[model samples]
Target: MSIQRIAAAATAALAAVALALAGASPAVAGSPHFIRNATTASLDGVSLVVDFKEAGLEAGAVETIQVTAHLDALYQCVNNGGKVPSDPKKTTISSDVSESDEFTAAKNGNLVGTLTVDPPDAASVLDCPSGQRSTLVSVTWSDVIIDDLTSGASLALTGTFSA
Candidate 1:
């Protein structure tokens, strides 16, 4: 309506945009342009899905998704310090292991859902040096990382399991 009112409104809008950009800019100075929506991330243990919503990856390009985490599992194995698991009845073996799963993401515009390459899940056989076993009794993971191998971009989860 009035000249003064219009100028004040434009200034306020400009200030708001500047503030938002200050917070939303990429961490690195020369980072890629499409890195705006890559902030939020998560890991689904039950479905083994590493999900990124509105990820802001290259619009429809194939992304190589790599996930790494620390794994601790309980197993059942021979009790007499044997490599081969001779028994399957007692759950008396525990080992600290690492599990990493990588897969090529389909061309799905920033919505990345890939299955983890879990050898331990399928094989379930522990060499079981002493108290190791042939069966995976329980599995726990921590320090999870979801990385875009194609773009050399990685997101270290902040919430431990979700982190």
Candidate 2:
């Protein structure tokens, strides 16, 4: 009876080991972790709202996020006695900009937040030629991306903010 019990236990252990090995998978280290609840970036009025997350960071880690983008801004300028509808004095200017901010990661390595971009406002850009007045009508941002400058993490965002 003792011999039969030992043999049964050994067989069961071997079968369990075989099943566990069949279900195991290789771990992919250094891969970017994606957050499911992140919101899509949007433009609020004349400002842009950056909503996103950076994964694979230490819990409560303080990090700097850098944003680089191409911007197309439309400015309406008053032309000296220019035709009202026929000669709408509007100018479209394009530029590349880089911005940065710092934040702390969550306990689960997700750094999430909303960034409001409204500064670097070029009211002076309204300084039109020939004593004309100008105002920024609208702006379009493209190929916008965020990078974890502190941790050197991979890209986290690539959304276009336009009205």
Highest lDDT against the true fold, candidate = 2
The pairs that clash in candidate 2 are none
Task: Estimate TM-scores for all models.
Answer: 0.45, 0.63
| lDDT value for model 1 | 0.49
- Kindly provide the TM-score of model 2 when superposed on the true structure, using C-alpha atoms: 0.63
- How far off is residue 119 in model 1, in Å? 5.7
In model 1, pairs of residues that clash are: 76-133, 77-133, 157-163, 158-163
Q: Please report, in order, the local distance difference test score of every candidate based on alpha carbons.
A: 0.49, 0.68
Model 2: weakest 10-residue lDDT segment is: 26-35
RMSD (Å) per prediction: 11.8, 8.4
TM-score between candidate 1 and the true structure = 0.45
Query: Candidate 2: misplaced stretches above 4 Å?
Result: 1-39, 78-90, 119-122, 129-132, 156-159
Deviation (Å) of 90 in candidate 1: 8.2
Per-residue CA lDDT of model 2 for 79-139, tens digit only, reads 5564333455676778776767888887777788766665245455555556555667778
